[model samples]
Target: MSAATVSSSPKITEKMARESPAEQAQVLVKSRICNPNFIFSIFSNPPDSNYSKLKYIISSSLTEACNNSVLLLGPRGCGKVAILELVLEDLLEEYPDMISVIKLNGLLHCDHNCALKEISRQLCQEHQLLFSKMASFDDNAQFMVSMLRECGLAHKTIIFVLDEFDLFAQGKQLFLYSLLDAMQSVTSQAVVIGISCRLDADQLLEKRVRSRFSHRKLLFLPPSREDTERLLEHILLLPTNSSFPHEYVTAFNVKLLKIFADYKFKEIVDTLSYSDSTVNHLQRFLFSTVSHMDLKSGLLSLENFKAALSTIQRQPKLEVLKDCSILELYILVCMKRLEAKEQELRNFNAIMKEYKSIHDTFQTSNYYARNVCLRAFEHLLQRELISFEDNRGHGQSAEFRPVKLLISRPELYQGLKSYPSCPVSSF
Candidate 1:
């Protein structure tokens, strides 16, 4: 695999030159590495992999037509959800007619009522039943239990995937209790699989709910540095036997290897991994890098990764502050000034007082009206530039609620530098 082979291939060069930008992109898309579906094959379950362990548990329960429950715990990007999906996908293929799956997320269906409504909705969709919102809590509960019984009678195994499982443990734990209790009945054959980022997720369950659970937990951790490097190579290196010309594939892989060995590229990867070393973060980074590929620059280089790193690492809060009105910037500056003075329990009221002090001291002509400043404060809150302290009661007025600036000093400096109409002399 040498650069000379690529340059010597006149046929390949001619074909590339003749192809339009869209046509070249289509060619690139044909590469197995460039396609998401094809890429997942590289991540499929191995003989002794975690994928196999999970598949064994879920598949055995489905085969026996028995109720079972297990929890998957890992930090974000550890492939907890991905592995489950892969296992379930293969299992569903093996027992398509006998298996059904329902997915619920903690972020969306955290509340018991909302979760029940969503479960009813999903069950209705899956079974082709006309879904109607039941009028009472008892009616909805009965309906769900009846649906489970119906599925069980028909020998269909229902698999429930609860994402952010810890959130479902909130409140009265009614959802968790009801689902687990239903699993206990002889008429129900269902498997509950919970996925959570928290390692102590199992400890969060109520005593009753925990008693019904199978006490099986699978933990996932982020890949080590070596594994991450291997993943990068696996994703970027073109297949030798792919549709592309042999010379092009070799040349592309060679360039990719060189880029991987570069210290600058390693630095970029380190910077990304320092904050978030998850597969999800790597996916986003790669997606950005790959988007820069084109007919002219068909092969990736160190520059592409550097550019992608810059784009991904940008602070969105700074961008939002740059677009803010002058009054809003003034409020933020006041907060920064108050922070510098080591003031304690600063809130909207304190910010206003600080602003007045500055206004009177400087006699600034652009002093925004008090009502306008109030509106600006509200706008800042909405933008998440400032957040109210959690210890403050909900009934407390907004003006008196202790607040903190979300942006750092460096970000503040950067944003002010970019604001074209910043009143430098007034401050």
Candidate 2:
């Protein structure tokens, strides 16, 4: 066959045209070198402020120990991993010859053991030739110790960044304990940086492991509204432009940006891109739902907008709630109820009573109460709407209090005031 005849195909041209605009845009964007301006612009001035309080915690921990282990605690998309990457970048620039960084995200694996094995495998691959002599150590601990020795001697420091570290700790606590013990023996020249979304005080770290990382507990505060807005502006603005169209940016639409911006910069971008792909999903809902009416009204008062939101809230598919879990729903209800009362639910018992009243209104059976409440409380704590003041015992019976309930769905609050009991079921 002639090369020209084979190359000139109408089918291929048609296929290219059929590709989505967003996908085509992505392909074009990915084909070019990443724009440094775009990357840097997403970050605000005094760059440290963009990081919230985490920047200080990370810097303080690194300054304290040449061989430190830090547990960054926050919910998913809260930017624990991004901050670590930024720290790694800084470390590499400051001590290129002395530092060797390895980052492993635990969520990629099937379980904690698999995550550990993957990390070990990656470490082996990276420094295979250097640790060729210590190949006899078959177990992970021995292997890690041998690798640490090689790294310590060859480089001044070695940092292992474990993102989603909770995945590894969930069922494989013993394995983590062993890993931490092994890392502790690294001649004061190695460190481990662990990141996780949940920070159960009792389960945050094993007692022995906790002792090792006590001084390095870095809590990442959620980004402020102002910081979130600035971050969103950076995200929406193209590198070529200093500002985006005002029509494309507004307070009502800004909540989506704020929600995603609460996470790390990279995560915010990933979520935004995902939201863009399903743009119609939200847009459809907006038009068919309250947002559509609110837009038409032209005077989007907070109260009216909230009322519209309440109507739309009831119509969400059950599948979405299932994916979010009963506990998540329970927490959502608690937040709504508290907002309805126009008083912050500070006391643990008081919050529980409010939750129980809603549960009773829903007629949740006795068998379901404990499990449902536990799940809801845990989810709320994970999302930073509430926190555990004390854990009377291990596992599910722990007591918790609202640290601060950041409820964005103001409409749900208003709706609950009229029908407090089982407001979810009422509409």
TM-score on alpha carbons, each prediction: 0.67, 0.48
- For model 1, state the Cα shift of residue 342 in Å: 23
Mark the regions of model 2 whose C-alpha exceeds 4 Å error after superposition.
1-65, 107-116, 128-138, 186-188, 201-203, 238-339, 342-427
TM-score of 1: 0.67
Q: In candidate 2, what are the lDDT values of residues 15-130, reduced to their tens digit?
A: 55776433332232322212222223234235354343443444443455346666787655445565555555555565566766666776675254554566577777765633
Candidate 1, residues 68-152, lDDT tens digits: the string is 9899999987788877876776777778898888899999998888887888888889889898875466666778899889989
Model 1 C-alpha lDDT versus the unseen true structure = 0.78
RMSD of each: 9.1, 13.6
On a 0 to 1 TM-score scale, where does candidate 2 land against the true structure?
A: 0.48
- Give the poorly placed runs of model 1, Cα more than 4 Å off: 1-41, 315-427
Error of 2 at 336 (Å): 6.5
Candidate-wise lDDT, in order? 0.78, 0.49
In the predicted model 1, the residue pairs found to clash are none
